[model samples]
Target: MTKKLLKSASRCIAALALTGAAGPTWAVESVKIAGFTWPGYGFWHIAAEKGLAPDLDIQYQTIEDPYESFNLVAAGQLDVVSSTAEFTPVGVERGLPVKLVAFGNLSYGTDKIVAGPGIETAADLAGKEVAVLEGGLAQIYVAMWLEQNGAAYDSVTYRNIIADDAFAAMIGGGVAASEFWEPYGTNTLKALEGASVLAQSKDPYWLQSGVIADGHYMSDALINDRRDVALLTMKAMYDAIAWWKQNPDEGNRIIAGGMSMSLADVELVIGKNGTGLDGGLYVYDFMEAAQFCGSAPGNPPFDQKNGQINDHWNLVSGWWVKFNLIEAAAPPETGIDCSLHKELYDSGYRG
Candidate 1:
């Protein structure tokens, strides 16, 4: 079925289920969520398809531009957004009514900085144009990599382009290097004769930095007026993750079908195996994520300290300030709401 038809059918099913047509009638809270077309954000579809949160109606929509998603949430049109983890600081700085409530997943080796032949290091791209989605995580990744490798962040010119355009630019020799996620990075190396991956998110430094990650964000209206619904929505996400881990193939199919992506492409980023694959993403389960948010009692996995969410926020905020995307770094509490995670843990919920 077409995406429009699928969404229509989902709404119809939700309505029928809520009206007691198939079973008992109960209060069903409807949540409107928006995100770009990325596999990490596709789990909500799984939650809805598997009836993970039968009490909540999840209406997931694909909005290619994340800034627009944030704007919609801020305007009370959207209740939740699954997007890059770096944007909450910008939202808080701009006074947007949104808070990141969960650290969803980290890019293992999915995100890469690929460079053309002879550009062996970050310094080689100095004064040359590098394609990136301006003000997005790609730009931040490239800038951070550059600064870490003895090159100044401002030394290179950033060409504002989407991933598809950036791929074409890389293949057409239009840019020296560009940051890409998943299949783009893989495809670039295969299609371009001499392209090389200079850095990947799974590298020791990037992994420890927790820079290239995805998260769940919700509007203040939902948190303030519909707190229970917000908590259930968060629970549904991790429930989806747990379900996916137990049933990888079927779960991947659900995500692939929901996102209108090829099964191979979905596997390329999220992996077909139940474990965290070498070139795929690292999905955080409920407890690990809670610890990362400092809501649980233990340290997070991957050598990351407990309550690393604050450090992650500060790191991204500092970069945003350097990028001139924000005037100054906002306090972590202004952008992150960890109470939901804390509530889940304190209630002895573990997944």
Candidate 2:
């Protein structure tokens, strides 16, 4: 399973025009966000709970299914969404009025490929029934592992299932292997006797590979009309990140409560699972994110090609076409827009 990873504009000119021809209209004062049940995306809750963006009247909700959130945004019911970054290209292909605004976190050690007893290697996964959230990062994940280990990509049967269900299936004797993110992956390892992790995102190879990330995406309605709202939203995110950095323990509790996950689960997501593999979510703090936004001197080391979003945008868009996950390749610009982040960073906002 992959838990993967907004707006505004005009007015004054039209107000002056009202004395002559016409008046301008402003965007909504409220910001409604739909996010998934992942700790990385939980910062929105912190932003809302702590009144980080009080002027925007920010409201956030947790929707377990990512597609539901995308649909809601497409239908104009939501202003923005926090989801896996891979879907941004898919959304653009389908003509969804969405653009990736800022990245949330690197999967780091979160995404994992776990196999039941008796499967020892990626090649051993051949002919096994592998469960993954189809068309999402999970499939890409398993495929990358298989390819890296010299296994045929089509060697196994691919079952499209959510991570939680896949975990249940793995436990109940259906899937021989499944891709999962923590704490599901950790929980599965603890629950099943002899089950082993086949591949982990935290592994040096995958971490340096720059294959996956989580992000925040906004609708055109939000980006085009309410840019002020969008900027404020990004500021709130950095503020939340800063707050969490200074108060990790309390922040984890807030994330757990807001995400409806247990504190242990939050710990697992934050890389406190004690696996000692440098695992856990690599949440970029304000300065780090600004650098990743290409707004600073040194970009994140994960992708050295510049930053996480740019590299993955190029990588995923190509892979999506190669895998036929999308009809054709969409321009990286169509899916990702880091200008908002640059604007905020340049403003010298401490948080």
Candidate 3:
């Protein structure tokens, strides 16, 4: 029999052997989960590859776009998605019935504002045309950078385009600068002679606030009907993190193959001890996540605070509202849920 069928059979036998009480003490529930093509999100693939949640039936897919993934969740075609946390407010405002269940990683230096040759500082960006992925994290990064650098929000021209297009624009001299992440930043610096990064999210000001973290969210339907499955799914994610910690090299290979990214690129994102890509992104382990979501009591080391997810959401959601990315900032109670991580941790889910 297939694994699902075998699991079902075992559960049925156990229930019958126990006098068929018809209680809530059954086996796992089938879950449908998806996420974009990012290293942090790819950890779910680790769960699948290692059979971490053998009792639960998990269906994971790769959906490149966050909006599309949430749309699927809204239509009941998907149960959960690992995506950028900035979209939580937008999803709530649009009535998507999704919740930010847990955070994944903090973009240490992945996102950047790259300037072409002859632009040395943030002030140089004044009056110059800059490209960004409008209505996405790029816009938010650039906006926050400009504001922090004593530059006016409208000091420069904003060209909204896709990341690849923005890269092309910067290379062709169509725009003086653009927001880029990962290989894109590496590519821009290599392709354009004398190009440099003016600002990045890794700085203490940005990193300490947890403004650019990735997240895993579940649909209301799944959280309501299959709460146990939701808990099991999260437990699998934590298990994957623990496994990756003890086996970084092998884990990177699995993630690279599963996400269709090069091993080198995967290393760039995962970085040793959260210092990858010259401080690109800081990968959060299960313990760190528990503290971040306020599910774990007390603050562990590593500059993280308990219950910071809601605070971070408030900061980013306010920015979204100010930039008109969403209609309004949604309350934390509407979407943020840290209790899931806490419950698993308390239950001794070290993995």
Candidate 4:
């Protein structure tokens, strides 16, 4: 057995040996997690601060580069990572031993395709350089917009730039357009003359697509060797979301404090209002996500059909293939492990 499995067995034996005595004392499992500094990914901070999973030592590292986070997970340096939902297929195609275990939240209107001055339409961007975090959801979003607007997917040259750099490129007139989220998207519009949003994620097409979203990924080792820890970690995430629903102010404060972001900036993504989608993201509660994953029996909110995770996975895989990010599409089951959601639902976890 793996070291983690042996350790778990030992812990169980110890707990059984202590039956009918004082409360069993077991060693806390140390779960290392990483994510970029985004408000949507900050829920892990809430899970930590609130002590939702007391049995697990949640160590969350803020690594701005999500690709690095995935690298760490593949290298056995991290257990879980919260990141954009669309990368699982890419990871699978690259032979990374990482799988997306749960869908966290959806972008309501936080993500935008912003065009710089003199770029009036999709056709205008042809032969021009557009900025995006190449091999990411931003690239897919922009490509989708282009195709929908009668332009070929490869019409524009893609500059593989991060959002912050993309913002600067927009202001400096270095690129015709870029994909951005939250403060950067809004700020680009404010900073550049004639800059306008070409498309927002909250639109019916984008919402139904569910492409712009966040999720939790776990290394194959964690899911296979430390199943209990994986389940507990996933539950703790929902527990944090439940607490946030009840205490939005405190939760937002905690998120902002942990992320070193302004409260206003955090609110712009997560929202101050009690409604989850009032801000920029539609934070999925446990049950709603279960529905999306087809672990439960009902349609997800926003008119999304149940079991849409399969569709979303295939859709992203198709885009990755088109962009040459992956040679071919892998089966959705290879990248997504919805059994965690199913287990949680079977255990009567409603939120």
Candidate 5:
């Protein structure tokens, strides 16, 4: 389930915390986190492998859906979560008390719209059905792309299929075309015959220059109350990213094993995304990372330097409120706490 409604994430987080198995040690309160099977979350895989978290023990569980992840972190069952852009706003709106610590990756050319043999153009999809993980970021992007191309969202019959599930159905002719997030999108393109690129998040026509797909997030309570841990984790994350750059093949292998995909397929997915295991800005220089993930004018989804929310994030929040995606009574921007990332970035810790 791309955005499949599941109840296991938080439950798992709570269970892990209670078990206190974040690591083999207990001095600093090891952090337990649940991430999905994407390139971005593999940072933990890299970190844990390198023993970067000597004082910290972070247990990593790769959940497949974002919906479950938000509630898990919000419930304090999990210390951190890496979520997509749409889900974060939903979390905030529902008053889950989540915070946007840093973006996992801005969707460059990663997320894609692939069409099976018969379809050639977006216009050809006017009367045809297209598969998209219902209520997911892919659905939103596909709908928006159709709208931008002089068509209504209703132009195509939208299917409520997850990326992997959609791949199966697409092979069976359940839908002529579909849009899905990366790795899956890349996988679909390779599995299907004669598939053509209908669109990708990296396309310039995409709103926000395709910086709309936020790949990760965390909990505000944890960030505010247990900040020392957050900084240590961030530093470990940076180290992991650096290690990933020097070891893409190994990192991809580990990620592939975790995600249940073939090593070759994982390579393709990472290649498509352009970053793979070390899949982020890297903040190669800690001095710059503070600014990149900080509350400065350059900070994403908000202009901390300019005293405004990152335009991209604010746009998503406003869109949710305008479209009523959250509960009818929910405030779109209510749950997000950007200052958490800002504070973390500014508090003397470089990475």
Candidate 6:
């Protein structure tokens, strides 16, 4: 290729990029994202290492806890985040400006309300102690499930506990029943021989239909603030998810390493309740999610009829209001902004 011809081709590509030809334009600056300490965000690591985001700069930071991680993103220090569906509303209330872009994975059968061998059924849990992280999605889900089954949710003792300490409490037999997600749930059941699933949060009940799973979140300000770059990042993430779906063995290995678990353990986690470990990214038609969530008010940011999950937020928020965790009436609505995801969807940018 002669220098002149090469230069001509480069100019054509540049002109096309500048004119928004072929696909959505990409931002030229580097993108910094705050990711949680979990395997769901492993795709970013893989995509970055594989040079998937060659056109856009990608930076990853480890946020050991979700609370601090989302807070930072809301503060505009980070661009992207990952967490369950239960958090979008919370983010909105806290002024985070985060939006659900794509889903990663739901708990499937990973989360559970389990009791030591003695407390067999949900009915038996009345008056028994149940350990859980207070004010989290898990607690509310457990409560709702109990209520649905005619169990006395208030009758059970609720203990506020963190994830790290949850295992110890369950194993040492400090709590009769406990609500938790995997691999902690797996570890607890394994460590306690007498433990039995009082209620499993399997699909279609506890964590599905766009309700309980790991979803990709991006800042609305980042997209509207930097449109070209946000679109490109979405393309890059789609590539990452498609890449993993095609290579589960390798993908599992990477995610397992990221999660500090053995590959077999990762496999077990994915295998929770027959859930398929398909590639984590989805490139749905722009209006598809609106159909899914009923958010299609005007082509973008379609209706997210996620009352099931939203109810959890209100329940917890009310508890907080009652317990003084937050102000009585101010719900955190600023934290979640779906406009960016809605824009990409409405723009028909699948890449």
* Runs in model 5 lying further than 4 Å from the true structure: 1-26, 190-194, 205-208, 257-260, 272-309, 321-323, 327-333, 340-350
Global lDDT scores for all candidate models: 0.90, 0.79, 0.81, 0.91, 0.64, 0.63
Q: What does the lDDT come to for candidate 6?
A: 0.63
Angstrom error of the Cα, residue 194, model 3: value is: 1.6
**Candidate 1 at residue 237, lDDT?**
91
- Clash counts for the predictions, in order: 0, 15, 4, 0, 8, 19
Candidate 6 off by > 4 Å: 1-28, 207-210, 271-336, 346-351
- What's the C-alpha lDDT at position 302 in model 5? 26
Show the colliding residue pairs in model 1. none
Candidate number with the higher lDDT (1 or 4):
4
Question: Could you estimate the TM-score for every candidate?
Answer: 0.92, 0.87, 0.88, 0.92, 0.76, 0.75
TM-score of 2: 0.87
lDDT per residue for candidate 3 within 1-351, as digits (tens), equals 599999999997887878655554646667888887788777787888998888777777898778899999999999999988778888888888989888788888888889999998778889999898666777788888888889887788889865678789989999999988887888999999999989887777777778777888999887778788888888888788888877777888888899899988888878644233444777777777888888877763347688888887888788878878777777788878777887788888755
For residue 56, model 1's alpha carbon misses the true position, in angstroms, by: 0.9
Model 4, C-alpha of 5: deviation from truth (Å): 31
Q: Write the per-residue lDDT of candidate 5 for residues 184-239, one digit (tens) a residue.
A: 67677788888888887555555234344554466776777887787777677767
Candidate 1, 139-165: lDDT as tens digits: 989988888899999999999976788
TM-score of 5: 0.76
> How many clashes (backbone atoms < 3 Å, residues ≥3 apart in a chain or on different chains) does model 5 have?
8
Write candidate 4's Cα lDDT for 1-351 as tens digits.
699999999998887787746656668999999998899878889999999999999998899888999999888999999999999888987899999988899999999999987887899999999999898899999999999999999999999986788889889989989999999999999999899999999999888878899998999999999999999999999899999999999999999999999999999999997477789999999999999999999999888999999999999999988988889998899999999999989998887
